[model samples]
Target: MAEGGTTLEFTPTWVVAVVCSVIVIISLAVERLLHFAGKYLKKKDQKPLFEALQKIKEELMLLGFISLLLTVFQERINKICISENWLRNFMPCKKPSDDKDEGTTAHFQTFFSPPVLPATVGRRLLSEDSSAPTYCSIKGKVPLLSTTALHHLHIFIFVLAVVHVTFCALTILFGSIKIRQWKHWEDSAAQKNYNAEDVLQKKFTHVRDHDFIRNRFHGFGKSVAVLGWGHSFFKQFFGSVTKSDYITLRLGFVMTHCRGNPKFNFHKYMMRALEADFKKVVGISWYLWLFVVIFLLLNVAGWHTYFWIAFIPFTLLLAVGTKLEHIITQLAQEVAEKHVAVEGDLVVQPSDEHFWFNRPKLILFLIHIILFQNSFELAFFFWILVQYGFDSCIMGQVRYIIPRLVIGAFVQFLCSYSTLPLYAIVTQMGSSFKKAIFDQHIQEGLVGWARQAKKNKGLRKAANGNSAGSPPGAAAVQMTKVREEDALLRSQAKGTEIVTDQRSNSSS
Candidate 1:
């Protein structure tokens, strides 16, 4: 056993921090130095400086991969867990017992309870029980992972990965070389902007019938396809329907097959609708997907604490994507403008040709990115609360955290990835459901308040000396109207008297 093997330590955390910091510092320094050298070498050939930077980039990538391997497998390397029985003695007991000195549930509670660090640390060391038989060998206490079958399995997997990566690199190299050698390729080949349009169109378009049905065998459609088959097999139970019916149709059918239960599957429906809306209205810009993968990987690795650190990479990707998208869009517009300019009257709108949708994709893309990013942070916080127990924190409640997190995740998935059909369903359900969910009195009060607001607005306008005929002060400006009415009345009376005189003269 090593002399300092059982010492209290937080070495693993410190080592990871130091290694990462050193790697980052070295990489940045090299990149800056190369960039400065490139500026100086403008008079000289620029090829060497560019090559050096490229080599540095590749080296940095290898260094990062090695650092990651070390961080992940550090525990496997150290025999500390096996050698340190002193640390395990303080860990939570597997079960409760009657003995006071022996560790129990009570001991776990006492150790992890409120103000834990103060209460648990710096306890006087107790002597080991001499009456118990001691095991001299380490094998019984610590399982040897080197001899285990799992170690061989890990080695085999990594070997296969190395082969796969090497093959991919060779394929890319040969493909690039061949492309460069092709004669007049740039002049004869279809415009690069043409491919950009195809990409945007495919992203924005709904999945076609053939793709949707065929996709059932893929991981995504397994549940949906199975449900569709069950619905077809038991169509009579659900109620007899024509072959054309949407929900009961099988996997090969043109219609969308219903997957979840109709009553409780509002969230699923919402998600599908939301996805469709997102695709059509604000197509994904491609680069956001890369960041999403990065986020998921970090979360799985339990490195979610540094999730914010991803913002640096994400922002860079976003800026680059935006610039690329802008260039592609401008190129398309320029092509259109050139054709129109030849016609002498045709006008070309860049925006109309640039994006597939009326709204910008960036807005929706950012929204989803933000939501995905926050989910990891929230999941980590909940995990901590669950692992440490409720009494661990001053404001922690007795409720289970895991179940809450699961429900939260379910809701978050529905909210972010799908449209909320429940909102529309509730809206269509009308005033009764609204009254049940919200108070009828509150609704009435809101209505009354709205009416009063209109009245107040009119009064305010009148007080401000507005003389528009429709305003509240219109009655105050009716003196001329009243005078005109009186004059007309007197004229009618005079005409009646003249008609009477004419009738008497005719009778005589």
Candidate 2:
């Protein structure tokens, strides 16, 4: 460890452990604070706490992966520099002297010795010449790095970061636009009195039948024909969005919620929505399947650099997380179903709702732990990036680095926390839309049924009046017909009551 302008020394293992423990404690405290604040600010109809926590959890998950990648990237760069002896240029060395002494040998040994610090810290120490070296004579110390190398590396990393940010921005933009389009289509269908289930089933069918490869080639040809062979050729080529691009988008809507009514039988809906697509994927030709596999491999290789080693385990973790979410959803659905059956009602009880909202304690804790670990690592990596350039060194700044890492993590949490209100607003708007559509549909159905029942009753009364003048057998037949009609009306009334109960439950 080192203070301002002091000699660099190996940071004690205990110090590292203590710092990590403190970070974890601080993170947990912040989470609890956010949770309490959300609870305090919650309204009668809102779920501010759940919404805030969910957003934070998602942000942490993303940051964790990003942090791991950046950390690994920095490490790889450090290894390259070390292997090429490029770091030696930054090391403090003694001036060439004619005196042959033990002090000189010791200085040389210390200067050339393998760095005990982690690659990130070692690189930071070397790059940041905040103070004069106190460990060895600095008479022959070289510049940290050549001006050309420094500028090039800095520019390269800056560009890479910019590109990454730009890509993410574009993806979000396109996704939002697609979602808006889907909402518009849904609204149009609702206005025209289309059945929500039918619309969703039709979308699933289209997606299932879509040929991923064929659409790409067809869209490419169409784009080329429209744009012509000119300077815009490549632009048109890449910018040509196909039907296949929309497949996943459509599937997302279908799997997540039904149009008009969001609270449907989600587990069963997912199975039905995915069944055809799953079969289609599994039934693809062998050569095409091989192509798909190769394409996926190539994509993974191209996107992930040396961090693929980390990516493998992260990917596995993601799979596990996804499976856990699925299991939880299924279990909740089963519980809800059982409750409905046992109670002989469509309304879900408050207890069942609580169970749905609050998942198993152990599962939740494990997830939180994973998220916290990732978030801490990400913050530490971010601090390193800020203090030292991507390819720079850290020789004597362990104490400073730890504090900066903690500050960085805190800042990130605050930033995420600030977005809670916006997320809540957006979610509220979506809920309002679903509720509005559901209410309208229900109202129309009830009105139509009421009119039909009134008309049937009037007709039955007219038949009874006419039967009073007919033969005994005819009069008996008319009475029996009225009884059947009454039974049918009773069943319809019961069905309508169930719908009303469901609407009330949903509103609550």
Q: Return the top candidate by lDDT.
A: 2
TM-score of each: 0.20, 0.26
Candidate 2 vs. true structure, TM-score? 0.26
Model 1 quality (TM-score): 0.20
Task: Report the lDDT tens digits of candidate 2 across residue range 484-508.
Answer: 8778867877786678558633542
Candidate 1 per-residue C-alpha lDDT over 1-508 given as tens digits, one digit per residue, 9 for 90 to 100: 2222232353477777898999999978977986787667544543333343444445446545755674466345423234434323422222233344433233233221111222333221221112322232334443222112222223323332233233223322342333233223222321223222232243332222223222221222458445544433333222222211112112111111211211112222222233333222122224543654454333221133233442442443333233322322233234332342221111112232233343334433544443333343343343334433344331123343444444444433333212122112211111111112112233345565456556655655554554554554564555445445546645655554455335323321
Off by over 4 Å in 2: 1-33, 40-178, 194-383, 390-497, 500-508
lDDT of each: 0.33, 0.36
Worst 10 contiguous positions by lDDT, candidate 1: 246-255
lDDT of 2: 0.36
Clashes of each: 3, 10
Task: State in Å the error of residue 439, model 2.
Answer: 13
